[model samples]
Target chain A: MAKYRQIREDLRALIESGEYGPRALLPSLTDLTARYRVARNTATQALKELEQEGLIQSEGGRGWIVRPRPRPRRHGIDRYSRSTWAAGKAILIAETASQGMVARQQIRELAEVEAPEVVAVRLGIPVGTTVWVRRRTTFIEDRAHQLADSYYPLDLVEGTAIRQVDTGPGGGFARLEESGERLDEINEELAARMPTSREAIDLSLPPGTPVVELIRTTYDISGRAVEVMWSIIAGDMSSFSYRFKIPD
Target chain B: MAKYRQIREDLRALIESGEYGPRALLPSLTDLTARYRVARNTATQALKELEQEGLIQSEGGRGWIVRPRPRPRRHGIDRYSRSTWAAGKAILIAETASQGMVARQQIRELAEVEAPEVVAVRLGIPVGTTVWVRRRTTFIEDRAHQLADSYYPLDLVEGTAIRQVDTGPGGGFARLEESGERLDEINEELAARMPTSREAIDLSLPPGTPVVELIRTTYDISGRAVEVMWSIIAGDMSSFSYRFKIPD
Candidate 1:
């Protein structure tokens, strides 16, 4: 095998065996060169290969470190059950608590804006209709986990607490229900893709990490779409669970 | 703004505006240099930025081309409903037909192997217990879309047609039901990550593409875990849709 490839394989085995655990620093390029009797470029190539494989990351001057693989937060359909959220349970906090992690959210932007084309279509509103949008970044263990943007039609939530930065307990759905738009169903679509440079930085994602885009539309008992939420979740830090019966 | 960034923004706007449609090749580096009065490296840098953003691809000697964003195939819970698959409806073919696209599957491997740790856990089997695994790559419109591997307890399927490369009619589930194991429910978990080099090559994924990993466990009415399927779906080519009532 090529010298650089041999080095790469050795390092990969080490990482997989848990010898180099998550976030643990790997030997510096200088050390690798000295131990393997290879040039600095060869050592660098080994680390670069690992980075491209999403196994390690170069931390600026701190050198390469095993990319941390946190226990993924599992999101079950039960999170949307009225018993959980309507009782004032915050979804993020509840999920994090199960994993013994702390959770918080920073409200980034809360304002009334023109509904974008996608949001309008989902909400059954006219193009460019005014809407209320609440954008926030959710954090777990002090690290950004996802970006959520919830949009509501102006007529549906104009003067409601849903327009505020803090929607109080149970979040926006509760507020909507209290306003008489009791949520009856939810339609969720999930897609995964590479994060944009901006998203990567915002989520502190490692190189090669992807993000899952979840778009959910909540419908009232009267069959009206009341709220549409778009979430960009850090793929490495989360997994979504769903259970359903197979209808005959 | 830097010259390369300015060029990138212009190209991005063109792509977003549909002026440069999917799979459309951009101007050659020479042409770009002449038109923008810039060095070849500057034009190359602009294209590299787009590639990293998952917007374009370098086709070796053919140069850079806009990445084709095929209309994603949406998967809903109904796909697993007994009415769909029990009628011998092949999931992939039915899904593709809905999109007016062609679908095919190539069975790569059918054999009995010791269950891996993850599969064992999901199947409620002891580690190293033998299991039957069927591996296949699914294609849509002649492009690879996903890799699926289904595992069954060896003892349960050892002498059955389920071990065949093609499980006739309703696929594996149908045969299992005939064998007295009626599926009652399914548990699905989804996570996304960068594909390994082998997976990337097999799926023909672009530089920045990711794969959604879906692990589904099927349970019989008796609550026994009967089958576990692991699917690595090409992120750029698919989305999963699910709709359910918000439990009261």
Candidate 2:
């Protein structure tokens, strides 16, 4: 029993060490059996344990691959402030691409859904205002992990390129930046909740995976709320940090 | 249907307006019906919707009571330079109570756990080092919302008052201050992930909420990792911001 457990731990170590990058398939069970000098049955046991632990998944004839993990992206914490963007200089930007992480996603726009009353109030808009909602599902190695829905006031972004939803990743924010609306202030309300059935399916989460919710209101130079982004991230694979200087 | 939804929305508004705080039971269904000029059925429907939305929970004998809605605990955007702390004494001191909005959580020290492989690598310590793992939870409305499992080198904090841990709530850094270690640098990594079953239960999450994972390494003036604080926050209920200056 201990040997099986040890093999599982060792396999986990390889995944963590980036020996098998995100979404990379692992060696076959036959290969594993030869490498570790273990019986074929023992190799099977090790693979089963890894699958149960959410470290890897089997893809039919494709063999097993490292479970999609959120490659931590570190942006210059300064990029968030209005002052930093004003300078418009190249600063340190952390990319998961260098780590070879890929996410599959679909982005779509919804018209005229009744904005939830809680959201309506937060925007100071009348209930039932026609709000443009952008919805997305992000996948890792073909497995769902994040679901995000952003609501924008129809009048503000209507006729803008934002209306034509971009199916590619990172489209919304990039398009908004191109439109010359300086994202001035962002007020974010973060929370957590159990996944609804749809969320569970969309995130490809196991039966009980909880999701982090980020409700963000991005403002213009005048500090008027122009865009509200609601992001749901998989809880197990991401983290966040910010840097601030104490006010003089 | 609209009228009933309106009543529900209004009732929710009243509750959020703090007319009824957490653990405050609603008026009898009869009274609410009279006040809203709606039938008992309509009032009951409103209550049911609220329950489904997780704004209130019923505990058998206890009719509907306000559920503690997780709110963002403001994380100031500022640099941690010693001069900054000394200069902003007044503003810094005033923020101690967290704007008097969210309730503070108390933390205590229990038995310490040995270093895990990842922590060992981050701390630049040998694997299996005897690092003290301090477990604590932050509470709001008598419920835990933030769970921290911090690892420290026993040699640094052992025999000092910090190893004893505070029986209740206070800033963790302030405790270190007493021990003559002034925090000069902090390196933090932030990511998002789905919460485990234990995290969901401890945070009182409804079902599918994810969590924000923050790993912070605090160094004293000499630039060594003294304490590694790992914080788990309900993703939907938290937002992080920080401001820093470009070095001249």
Candidate 3:
């Protein structure tokens, strides 16, 4: 790698590893030159690039300091309280990036429990009825990215092969397809709010990072709302992109 | 409107107008009931709904408080050194949205002359060219929702019909199209970031709000980049959905 690129990567690594945090000042040009064994001009070049990228800032007398970044937040509609399989699937999607950070393995449990109030209303089921809950978290690059808790009704996944999605080759959707359940439509709602203190620590956010809230419900071929999933994304670190087709 | 809904609207109006800032506690249910001549239930209902919608929150025993929203900060990209028309267009966009509280209006003349180093490199323009800068704030239901800043090249809009996009029937793209410039495509690069204190105030964001940053560039039929627009949206106050056809 070129000298400047190497310096850039090193600096980035230091940031990701938390050696330098937001507002933390970096070494002076002369110090960087001696440490990196590069010319002062090259050090200047690397620092300039970093500043342009909005990763750092320079204060006249204070030199360079890190620009604060929002912690990673999850994005998706709220979780459904219908299937253990769907619950597991939702957790995977939420934690896919973050778990790699903390090196936590994904969970694949398949079981049933009572439905929560929000999920009950969406599923058109009683709030206290049996529902399956599948939970999981992703550890990306050894850092925890997200935590997902999903719920689903028990009738939907019982006596079917839909319970094995968490550990399945293609995951929950694949298992549902194999069970002859024709998945069809989806509805999604999104919002943003502050995370609980526990959530902030888990997502590794600055004290006040907000979480993007998304709740999604999927219907089957019969238009029956079969599954629901909710997710929380660290607001600063993530974005959700979807292409909506405008029907002709 | 129902009594509860009426109360909700009044409070919402006050909040949107900056009568109540983030973390500012609202009147107690008794106080609101006496002021609005509504039952305590109605007052509680109004506050509950707001909390559910993520607009306000109960500070435990301290009563409900306004949530802070994000403010926008402008970053200059290019200066229109010689464009008469471009300058007019920039002013139009800023002027139209400037009056209404809910209307998006923000203008930031990049301090290229003041901080040439940070402004020039981020914009990727020549060091000395003059760039007109504009910033915007979006609101949904009286909450500060998004923040954005744009930079325009001086030459493209200097004498062209496209400069009138802000007030006329067609936006910039339509104006360009009417002028016989075939706009073939638009490319957007998006990211999320934490807001600075200045940005938070301008966006009116509460602590922990994250912003969606977007850089959009329009290309003419011949594939030359014609215009660039940048936007920043508060994670909670706004959500963007776009539709694209799948290529065969």
TM-scores, in order shown? 0.90, 0.56, 0.53
CAPRI accuracy category, model 2: incorrect
RMSD of each: 3.2, 11.7, 14.8
Report candidate 1's interface RMSD in Å.
2.0
Summarize candidate 2's per-residue lDDT along B84-200 as a digit string, tens digits. 444433222334344564345455565667788767877889988888877777754455657878888887676655566552223445556556776667766666555554576
DockQ for model 1 equals 0.65
Per-residue lDDT value at B133 in model 2:
77
* TM-score-best of 2 and 3: 2
Per-candidate DockQ vs. reference: 0.65, 0.17, 0.10
| Count of steric clashes across candidates, in order | 0, 45, 64
Report how far residue B240 has shifted in candidate 2, in Å: 6.4
lDDT-based ranking, best first? 1, 2, 3
TM-score-sorted candidate list, best first: 1, 2, 3
Residue by residue across A45-90, what tens digits does model 3's lDDT show?
6776565345677788879888776344333222222242354544
**Candidate 2 per-residue C-alpha lDDT over A41-112 given as tens digits, one digit per residue, 9 for 90 to 100:** 778767765564456778889888887754443433343543333344211121333335565557655565
Q: Give a tens-digit lDDT track for model 1, residues A27-71.
A: 988889999999998888678667855789889999989988888
Candidate 1 chain A lowest-lDDT run of ten: A45-54
